[model samples]
Structure formats: structure tokens, C-alpha cells
Target: MASDVIVRFDNILALDNFSVSIPRGVVGLLGPNGAGKSTFIKTILGLVEPVSGDIDIVGLDPRKDVMSIRDRVGYMPEHDCLVDSMSGLEMVTYFGRLSGMTKEDSIPRSHEVLDFVGLGEERYRPTASYSTGMKQRVKLAQAIVHDPSILFLDEPTNGMDPLGREEMLELIGKIAASDKSILVSSHILQDMEKVCQYVIIIDNGRSVAQGTMASLLDQDMTKRRMTVRGSPKSLQTFSEQIHRDFEETSISEEFGQMNIVFINDGSFAMILDMAKGHDVQVRSYVPDRLTLEDVFIRSMKRDA
Candidate 1:
């Protein structure tokens, strides 16, 4: 696990063991509120040192080589720290210079990053006059001004409307495509679901699950559940016939639908064929794919 690993927090054994590997590309650090996701990141960034165990970012010990790690890592903190008098470009340039960028390089790179984050025209506007979404973009621009290889984003979608969220997700996806690894910590499972291929779930400071979406959801008994509506009585009759003939079908009280669990990973074609043969006249059939929410709920149940 340590091979090709950029960050590792091994067996702290606190409430959360804090162990997971963040490979290249976009990986989500998913958890509910107070799940210690932020704390774990802070510990890794050397902001909050761990009491026991070890942590390394980019093969450099975060504690011993804090400066080296900071140089190569971009962090967009969750809190709002924009200065009222500073323009977006100024703020970005300031951070860039602080990160060791010379004035000549900082000025142009500030525009490049602000433009990359969709703040080109408004780069000169004071941050205090910016909207919430604009402020978020400013923070993002500053984080990437130094051109870090890794980005640690804390709730990048926070306070964003639906459109803003989508735009932010697209931007994050572009960053991932451009060869920078992103570790985004967020409580919003749906938002994270759209961007992350791999997820690391932590609960009460313990690593709950860490894998690809498919791998995490593979343990679910109900990987696919859908409701069919249009004619209640006909659906019920179809369901009853299926139950009477085949024992694999069960009625779901929650959704009031004929819930069928696939045995031995049966294909969807089987259900379609069964419906056609029975002359059920199904109005519609939809399959619900597994989501991060389902995996999180299952992990919570297992922990309980």
C-alpha cells in the first residue's frame, strides 16, 4: 500500500485509525459531519500533528519536511479568509509570492490561475464585493497559484448553488485530467459522487471503507432497486405471479413495488424477458445504480 502512495496515516488507533492511500487522480475523502476528515487532513499537512503512527506526503515526512511538502501541495481551506480590500488577482499574486514566486512570474501566473478558475474578467474586483461563488473561486486560484502537484480541497462545493456546484465539479475534473491528484473532503455525498472515482470513508476518526465505487458497493445486497409505476393493480398482479412462481421476488413496503433481488448476478435481460413472457405490460422498469450514500449507510450500520 505504501508503494506509489502520496499520503498515508497508519493505525493511529484513535477513534479513527486514519489509514488510507491517495493515489493519482481525484479521490474523495467522504464522511458525515464530525467524521474527523478535516482533522486527518490537518494532521497530514502538519497543521495538527498526530500523537502516534506515521504520515508521509509525497515521500516527504510531513512533520520533518513540512516546507518541502507545502511547496508541492495546494490547499483550499474550508474557511473564508478573503481580505476585503484585496482584489482577486492581488490575493492570488500575494499567495504566489508568499509561496516563493517572484513578482514578474507571480503577476502573470496570477492571471493564468484566476482565468483558469473562471475569474478572469473579475480578477481586479475587490474580494469583499464578490459573491460567495466568486470568493470560493478566489480561494481555489490562490491554492493553485504555486502550481502544486497535489490539491487538498475541503468542501469545495460548499455554499454553491446547483449551477455553481456543477461548474466547480467540471473545474475539478479538468484539474484531475491535467495530472494533478485531488483529495477533496466533503460531507455532500452526491456532489462527491459526480467527481470521484475512488472514495475513502472515515467515521468517528476510523477508516470505514476505501476503494472504488463499484468495489465499495459490491457488498450491498440491494445493489439495484427500482420502483415501477403506472398501474398499481396490474403491477401488484404481476408481482404476485412472479412471487408465486419464482421465490426470488419480494414485495417492498417502503416503495410499494415488486422488489426483485438478482441471484448469482443475474442480468437485467432476465427480468425483461420474464416480464415479456408473463404479458405484464410493464409501463417502465428502471435500475437504481449503487451510490456513495448506500455505501455510507451500510458502513454506518456495520459500525453500529
Candidate 2:
């Protein structure tokens, strides 16, 4: 069941029966801009109402149990909302208090959460002076101050350099390691591929694909890819041998490499055997299986 479901604007259906079962570890929401990724998160946060359907958070309706859900779910908003005057420590403590923790509980918990995000000593400094990474850390710390069961982070690594992005990714991994489920939205394909075990791809307000990585890859029905690399002459030589050996094969060549698609296992093995005999170095060999990106593209194309 979807929690925080929504359909906005008469012209646009933000979520069209968009439903997914989330479990522990990181679940990625991948889509291009205006693909309803942001709208989905906002709806789940109870920031927007759905025209139809229901959103249940751990069996409680987000609309009816907004307060309870707010306390149980931690969210790192996409935009910057931190007050410049407030120190990292003060900000986290403030959120903790707002979540129903007493002063005594909030203060110590703030430091712990900041430390967990790798901002221990810097927690006392004003966020105004912090770098983008540090501010992101503070935002993350505040979200987890109350130790929520689930965390929703939207573009957590936005505006970060490569190094900063890596560090933030590691911290997110740690959060997932603590046995809490995480739902993260990001447009960066490579980054999302690193953290999420399950992926949900949306396009034009519809869920194009949703499943585990392996399941998505298995959808293609064929699981074999050939890469012939070396001199262009050798590539051409090897490709001709493959074409002569297999009756049903499709070839796509690019950048001095040949991608051979074989429909049957016999043809796949035949190509490999021939390549070995010719002494051609296969630079890269991967199965032509589907990927999350592939499935996304294929599904969208099918619907179109």
C-alpha cells in the first residue's frame, strides 16, 4: 500500500497508482525532472493530498496519523531550510524538541546524531559558515535526531563535489546498516546504482519499472553479450567469424568494439570459442541483460 499518495493538477497525474513495497536497506527513486519524483516524496510527507488512493505508513494513514508519522519518519528535504543564525547543534536539538524529546533528551541526542553524521566537533559552529557537505550533514543529523524507523532523503548529495558525494553516500550506507529502511530520490544514475538494492523508476508520472536489481536485469530473456576489442582489423575479423558461425545474431559496433547479441546459448559459446582461437582480446564482456535504466527506457518506449 502507498503511504502519502497524491494526484495533483488537473493536467498532470503526479502518481498513477504508484505503489511499491519498501523494505530495509536503500530503495532508489529514479526519474528525470518533472517525472513526478519530487511530487511523490511530497505526497508521502503529507505535504500534498491525493485525489484518489490511500497512503498508509506502518498501517496508519498519513493524513489521519500525520503527527505519529512525523515522529516515526525522518525526512531530509531537498531544499535548504536551515536558519543561518542557528548552529548545527542548536538546529538538531530544536528538531528533537519539536519531535517530543525533552531538553535533557534533545541536547545529548543532538550531539549523538551529529556525531553519527561525522560532524562531532563542528556541531557548535553556525551552519551559515559551513560548507555544502557540512550543511548536508547537519540536515541529515536533524532528520535522525529522534531515531525514526524510516528515512526519506531527496537529492541528499545535490551541490556536492565528487568527494563530498562519496562521503555522504557512505553515511547513507551506515544509516541503512542500522536496519532502517531508506527511500532516496536522485537523478544521478551512477550514484543511485551504488546504494539501492531495489529501484523504482518513474516517467511522465507513471512507474515505468520497480523491482530488485536482479529481477530487472532478468526481464530481457537473453543473458549474453560479446565485446571484441583490439585493432579494428582484428575486430572485423572476429565479427565475421561470429556472423558465419551463428544464424540468429545482431551486431552493433561502436568505438572499435563489437557488441554481438546471440539468441541461443550455442551461438554465444560459438562466438567465445572463435574469439579465443583468433587470439583477439575481449576488452569487455558482459551479458546483454536488462538494467534498471534499460527497463525504464524500454517501458517508456512501449507505452509511447
Candidate 3:
């Protein structure tokens, strides 16, 4: 957790009164480039000293207890920080040892984590020989080799293909299920939506929005939107009826489907009744909700 955190570099501010109370779960850290997400992480890791503010990681102060914090935290950096000469197993084992694990413990633990990240036999190959996805997996393996209680994953799915990205997200979900607190930073909003229970959106080095995924997306409850599918003629008749009653309603049609948005006071039951009266066999009627991308864009615009 951080409060009133301020960090500057040679007159350029990186964190301007930035503050956030991250909950214990898989939380997404979202921002545009240069929004200070990486700087925030570094400050928490004690790699960047804030000019003013207090920061606590799991109860210990990063300023005074950085060593202790490192022992309990795992960090998968956004950029590649691999030693090309080292094999996957060797690289992970080295990080484990650095995390204070004994050789006896680090070796097997390295293999276990490597397997968890799907490196398996590839663990024997040099990291330079691995593909981008494999390299990303190996990076994750090293981060968790010591079994830290907290994880900071920066762009964990960078360079991964569709299947690979899905697999990475699944791994993150499993980790969250284990109760280990994770803070993930990714440009991919969809991936964050799939795994994050909470999200903090930042811009210009300031906290713009932070909340539970559902709460953030459902902030505007006054407007109701839904998609309806029916025959073209039936849909047109239904649309006309809705417009006649709810003058403020907006409807767009494409390929025998209609996307409708109206004031929440307009009842969905009434719409269904109109459909029935118009002899429209509603094939599908589903509520449309705001997505993480929608929330992120809105937050950035509001902050701007």
C-alpha cells in the first residue's frame, strides 16, 4: 500500500501524489505508456526512492525493510532480464539462490516452477535458444521459484501468441486461486479483465480510478443497454414501438440484430411485451455491460 507517494527524476515527475490501497488478490495496474506504472513498481521494490510518502508491502516498509520485502516478493520484469548463456533451469535456480534459498531447496524448486510454467524438458536448453513464449515462461518460473507470497508480473504475456497468452492468463488465475497476492501490469486490457478482480487506472503519474472490476464497470447504472436478435421485419416493428414510447432511446441495427440503449427507468419487461405484441420471436436478448477497456478509456479521458 502507498500513500501520497511522490517520485521525481531531475525535475521530471514520475509519481505525482500517487496513492493506492491494493487489495489482496489479483489486481490489475493499468495506464498508458509514461503513466508511471513501472516507476510505481520500482518504488515499491525500493529501486526508486520517493521524495515523499509512505509505502508498505505486506506490512513492512520498503524503505526500512527492503531486504525482508524482497524475500517475500516475486517480480517478473517487463523487459527481458535473462542471461543468454544460462540454461532455463540454471537461470531459475540462480534466482532462487539469490532469493535466499539453499542449493538443496532451489534446485528442485526450480524444476517444479519451470514445470508449472510449462518449460518442462526445455528447462535444459539455454535461454538464448528459447522462443519468445518460452522465454516469457522461463521468466515467470524464476519469479516464483522461491514461492514468494506476493507477485508483481509486468507484461507477462508480452510477445505471446493467442494460445500462449491464454495459457499465461490461466497460470495467473491458478496463482490467484492459491491466495498469493498478485499485481499485474499489462497493456492488454482484455487479459486483465479475464484475471483481475480489482483494477487501478493511473495517468500522468496520478491515481485516476481504482475499484473492484464489477463496481468500476457498473458505475453508470442509469443507462441500460442490450442486444436483441430477431427477424428484420419483426425487429424493425419492435424498434418503432420502443422509439414511440422512449423517445430518448437509441437503436442500431445490423445483420438482423439490434443494439439498444435506453434510460434505466424504461423497463426491460415492457420491451419484451412489445416484442411479443409485434410477433417478434426474440432469438436473444442480453444485457450489454462496460468492459475493462471501456472503463480504462473513460478514466484516461476524464483524467485528461
Candidate 4:
């Protein structure tokens, strides 16, 4: 739990009066580029101390129990942190030892975690020649080799093709299914939508929206995701007719449908009548709930 936390880097305030009660689950730390996500992770890990406010991870205070926190918390950083000369198994073992495990314990644990991360055979290969996805697996392997209680994954899908990204997300899903907790920080909202149960949206180095996925995006907005069947031109003209009749703001067309966003005073009854009069097909007319992407936009544009 963190309340009224402020983290500054020199003269700049990286996090501004941040307050959030993050529940234990697959939580995503969502933000735009340079929105203090990395800074927030560092503060939780005790790598960067906050200028003011309180932070308690599990039952321990980060300031006094840095090593204990490090021992139980796993971190997979976004940037490359691999040693070119070492093999994958050796890399994981080294991190395990650093987490207070003896060589005897680390050796087998490294193999088990590497296998769990889909790096079984390649554990003997040098990390220097590994692909981007493989390197990410190595990073993940090392982070969890010590069997930490919670994991922090920063930009788990940074660089990869479509297939690579899918595979990485699948691995993350498997991890999330386990008992261990996870906090993923990323600018990519799609991956977060796929795996996370909760989200904390940040902007301008401040917390904006934080809640469960369904709750945060549950409200219907000004737009409607209306799928219709008709000629493009007729849809356009009918849109104009609706605007003229019901004081609709605009009519935006995509594919075979149109977005009819209007004030609450406006009614979908007009749209139904228009469809009936024109003999056009109305496939579906449902309220448009904000997507995770849309919520991020709203959070950034609106003041915290």
C-alpha cells in the first residue's frame, strides 16, 4: 500500500502525490511513454526512495527492509540486463545466488525455472547469440528462479514480431495463473487487456484511473458501436439526416457502419426510424463503453 507518495529525480518530480491501493492480482501499470512507470517500479523496489510519503510492500517497509524485499520480490526490467559471456543457466544461477541461495540450491532451481520459462534446451546456449524473445525469457527466468512472492515485469513485450509478442503474453498468462502476484508496466494497452485483472493508469507522473478492468470501462459514453448494413453513401446521407433531426453532433463511418454520437437528449429511436424508412439493415446498436485505450486517453487529458 502507498499513499500520497512523491518521488523526485533531482529538480524534477517523477511522481506527483501518487496515491493508489493496488490489490493482489495481475495488475498492469499503464501509462504513456515516460509517465513515471519505471520510476514507480524503482520506488517500490527501494532502488529510488520517495521524497515523501509512505510505502509498505506486503508486511515490510522498503526503507528498512530493502534486502528482505529484494529477496522476495522478482523484477524483470525492460532494458537488456544480460551478460554476453554467460550461458542462460549460469545467468539465472548467478541471480539466485545473489538472492541468498547457495550454489547447491541455485543450480537445480535455475534449471527448473529455465524450463518453466520455455528455455529448457537453450539454457546451455550463450545469451549473447539469443534472439530478443529468448533474451526476454532469460530475464524472466532469472527473476523467478528464486521463487519470489511477487513479480514486477517492466515492458515484457518491448521488441518482437506478432508471433513473438503472442508467445511472450502466453508465458505471462501462465505465470499469472500461479499463486504469485504480478505488476506489469507497459505502454502497450492490448497486452494488459489480455492478461491483467486490474489496471492503474498514470499520466504526467500522476495516478489517474485505477480499478478493475470491467469497472473502469463499464460506463457508456457519447458514442455507440453501431454495425449497419447499407451502401456507404446512404449511410452518410442518413447520418446527416439524423444530425439534422435529432441535433446529433457528427456521423463517422467505418467499414459498413457509422458512429452516431450525440447528447442524451438525442435518441436511438431516430436511428431506428431512419433505418426503417430507408429499408436498410441495422445489424447491431449497442452503447460504446470506453476501451482500455480510450480510458488512457481520458486519464491523460483529464486532470488527476
Candidate 5:
């Protein structure tokens, strides 16, 4: 939605030359703390104006088509934003009305969204009495009360137990499975991997990576990790021989298992033949697919 966008707060530039077009799907916004993620979201919501460049929120300019952007888009901020005195229904209904829904329509829609978010019974209870998970549910309910086409979910599973985190991630997966497109921002790489088809990685106010999740994580297909189960002595001897024979290879042994990384091993058949001849038991071997966390670290270090 932005092209060469530069957003600044006072003297600090939050987004520099940020040019990216979001496709229609669930996308992840990943970055470390203070990586200009919030600033970027605010700029799209029209809360922060770009110092120089244009913004198109779902085809409507945020400057001239404020209402269109406001109506079609939904946002659930990272921190707690619920009104303690208001019940879930009241809060969601209020946001629904703010989205241009009539009072009568807002009430039913609010209940529907609260129920959809697994908070139907808690809709009437005051938010102050709710747990962290319930509060998150309320926030999610309010964001979707108006049935927006796109949602900006910032840390939807910020503080929760394992079960709660899983539930929230599953709920997000369900939402993304529907027609609604979501831009989910979080530091939790596992949750992002679960729900996101595409990823946008940012660091220090600049985008370091953006592409399909599979393509980004599996960028280098030639290199791979191989695990072989065998005796320590056998694996040790095997490892030494391979290390001396192959270029750009490292082997580590632990608990009678061998972990090998082919940094740039060019020949798969030759390596397999060598291992077979050395009597190295092959437990499993597959092309290396870097985890999201690995990709984030490598990308940040590369950019740095």
C-alpha cells in the first residue's frame, strides 16, 4: 500500500524508502523490538503522515479517502486497549458504530463477533474482571465487529499460557482461512509460521526481507542438515574423515548422534557414497529448510 514511503517522528525516521505491495493473503510482519513496525502501522491508519510519499490503503488514499480506509480496515494493537469499565459487548458495539454501523446493527454484530471469538458468555462481564486471554478475545472481537476486509493484528498472543497461545493462534488461523486478509505482527516466530503464507521482515526502520514464507525460508536449497545415528567413536571417525575430505562441512557429535551441516556441499551422491563406505548409519536426511527464527537472525546479521 506504500511506495518509497518515509515516515518520521520528530527527528527519527521510522520507515525509510519503504516500498511494498501486500497481496491478498495472511502476511506476517516480523521484526525485533522498536523496528518501526508500530510506526508503519500508524502511517497506514492515517495516524502518522508520511514525510514524503503516498499511501494507498486497499486502493483508497488515506489522505483523501479516510473513511474508506477506516471502514475497510481493522486493527488490534499490541498493548491492552480495552476500557476496563466497559463490557465486551459495549466496547465492540462502540467500535462497530465508529465504523459507520448503525446502533441497532452494531449490537447484533458485536454479539456475533464476540461469540465467534469464543467470548459470548463474557460479553456482558466487565473487562476489568477478565483474564489476559479474555481481554485479547475482546480486542479481537472489536476489531472484527464491523466485518472488515483486512485486519492488522499486532501481537495477538503477547501474554498467555501455552494453551492460550495455541488457542489464539488457532483462532487466527481460522480467521485467515476465511476471506479476511490479515497483517499479523509479532516476535513469536512459531505463531507466525503457523498462520502466515507470506512474511515481511523489518529491521531498524527498513525492510530486510519480504516474500512467500516457503520461498524465503528455503532460499538456499543446495545446503542441508543431515542427522546420522551411530556410535560416538564410529561417528567421530566418520566425521573426521568427511571433514578432511569435503570442503565447507562441519560435523558435531552428541549422544551417539552425528549432526552435519553442508555449508556449500556441491555433490549429494558423492557424499552419500562416502558415508555409506564409512559405515555411517543414516537416520534421516532432507534438504535444509531454515526456521523462521534462523531466517530472521541471518537476515538481520546480513543487513547489519
Candidate 6:
């Protein structure tokens, strides 16, 4: 958790009065490049000192209890931080010991986490010879080898193919299932939507929006939008008929659909009646809900 945090690099400001109460769940940290997401994570880990404000990790002050915080936190950084000569098993075991685990405990734990990340026999191979996905998996193995209570995963799925990305996300889901608080930072919005229960969007080094996924996406529920399908001519007539009644209406004949923003839920029934009157045999009707990408774009534009 952080309150009124401000971090500056000489003349450049990286964090501008940023504040967030990260909940105990899989929370997504979303922002474009240079938006202070990585800096925020480093500040919480005590790797980057803030010029002002307080930072707490699981009830301990990051400034005063950084060493203690490291023991309870696992960080999987975005860039490559692997030893070329060490095998996957050796690297993870080394990090486990660094996290204060006994060599005896670190060995088996490393193997367990390596297996959890699907390294298998590859764990014995040198990391230098491993593929990008393997390297990412090895990085994950090292981070969780000590079984920390919280995880900071910065671009955990970076540089991986689609299958590898899905596998990494599945692993993250499993970690969250065990009740570990995870803060994931990545450019991939769809992946964030799949895993994150709460999301925080940052822009211009400031907090743009932060809340549960459902709440953030449903903030404008009063303006209902839905998609309708029918024959082009009938759909056109239906759109023209309803255009004057609704406050806002849009029809895309190219897609054979219409979008309407209505005042109340009752308007849906009225729409169905209008469709019937216009001879528009509706094939399908579904609510067009806002996605994480939509929320991110809107927030960034508003901040700009």
C-alpha cells in the first residue's frame, strides 16, 4: 500500500502524488510505457526511494522494514536477470537461499517450483541454452521458490508466444488460488482482464482510476449500449425510427448492427417492440459491456 507517494529523478517526476490501496487479491497494474508502473513497484520494494509519502507492504513500512519485506515478497522482474552459466535448478535454489531458506529446504523447493512452472527435465539444462519461454518460466520458479506471501510480477509473460503466455497466466491463476496477493504489470490488457479482480490504471505518473473490475467497467450503466442483428434494410428502418427517441443512437450498416444508449432498463423492451414494428427479425441481441482496454483508453484520454 502507498499513500501520496512522490518519486522524482533529479528534474524528472516519475510518480506524482500517486496513492493506491492494493487489495488482497490478483490486482493488475496497467499503464502505457513510461507511466511509472515499474517505478511504483520498485518504490514499494524499497529499490527506489520516494521523495515523499509513506509505503507499506503487508503492514510493514518499506523504508524501515525493507529486509523483512523482501523475505515475504517475491519479485519477477520484466527484463532478463538470469545467470548464463547456472542451470534452472541452480538459479532457483540460489535465490531461495538468498531469501533465507536453508540449502536443504531450497533444493527441494526449487525443484517443486520448477516443476510447477513446467520446466521438468529442462530444469537441469543451463539457462543460456533455454528458449525465451523457458527463461521466463525459470524466472518464475526462482521468484516463488521461497513461497512468499506476495508477488510482484512485471511482464511475467513478456516475449512469449501465445501458448506460453496462456501457460504463464494459468500459473498466475494457480498462485492466486492459494490466496497470495499478486500485483501484475504488463502491456497486455486482455491477459489482465482474464486474471485481475481489481485494476489500477495510471497515466502521467498519477492514479487515473482504481477499483474492482466489475465496478470500473459498469460505472456508466445508466447509458446502456447493445448490439442488434437483422437484415440490412430492416435494421436501417429500425435505426431511423428509434434515432429521434433516444438521446444517442448509432448504426453501423456495414456490421448490420446498431448501438443505442438508453436512459433505463425498460428501454430494452421498447427497442424489441420497435424492431418488430420495423420488420426487423432480430437474430441476436446482447449487451456491449466495457472492457479493460476500453477503460484504459478512456482514462488515458481523460488524464491527457
Mark the regions of model 4 whose C-alpha exceeds 4 Å error after superposition.
221-223, 229-234, 241-267, 274-281
Over 4 Å off, model 1: 1-15, 218-222, 226-287
Tens-digit lDDT track of model 5 for 31-63: 898888998888888888888888777678877
Candidate lDDT (C-alpha), each: 0.76, 0.79, 0.89, 0.83, 0.84, 0.87
Clashes of each: 2, 2, 0, 0, 0, 0
Best by TM-score: 5
Model 1 lDDT tens row, 1-304: 1222122347534334467777888899877777777777777677776665667677888779988888988999898989889999999999999999999999999999888889867888899999889989999999999999989999898898899899999999998998998999887889888898888887777777889866775654443453454345656666666566553423563344445532224666776666665555444445545568877886787766
Task: Using lDDT as the measure, name the better of candidate 2 and candidate 5.
Answer: 5
Q: What would the TM-scores of all predictions be?
A: 0.80, 0.82, 0.86, 0.89, 0.90, 0.87
Model 3: per-residue Cα lDDT over 153-203, one tens digit each: 999999999999999999999888888999999999999999999999999
lDDT of 4 by residue, 235-258 (tens): 767766666765454466778766
In terms of TM-score, which candidate is stronger, 1 or 2?
Answer: 2
lDDT tens per residue, model 6, 1-304: 7889999999989999999999988999999999999999888888999999988888899889999999999999999999999999999999999999999999999989998999989888889999999999999989899999999999999999999999999999999999899999989999999889999999878999999999988876655565667777877777776677764533555566665544344556777788788877555555556778878998998999
Q: In lDDT terms, how accurate is model 4? A: 0.83
Residue 293 C-alpha lDDT in model 4: 87
Tell me the alpha-carbon RMSD of every candidate.
Answer: 5.0, 3.9, 3.6, 2.8, 2.5, 2.9
Ranking by TM-score: 5, 4, 6, 3, 2, 1
What is candidate 1's local distance difference test score? 0.76
Model 2, span 49-82: residue lDDT tens: 7877787777777678877888888999888888
Cα deviation of 296, candidate 6, in Å = 1.3
Clashing pairs in 3: none
| Runs in model 3 lying further than 4 Å from the true structure | 226-252, 256-258, 262-286
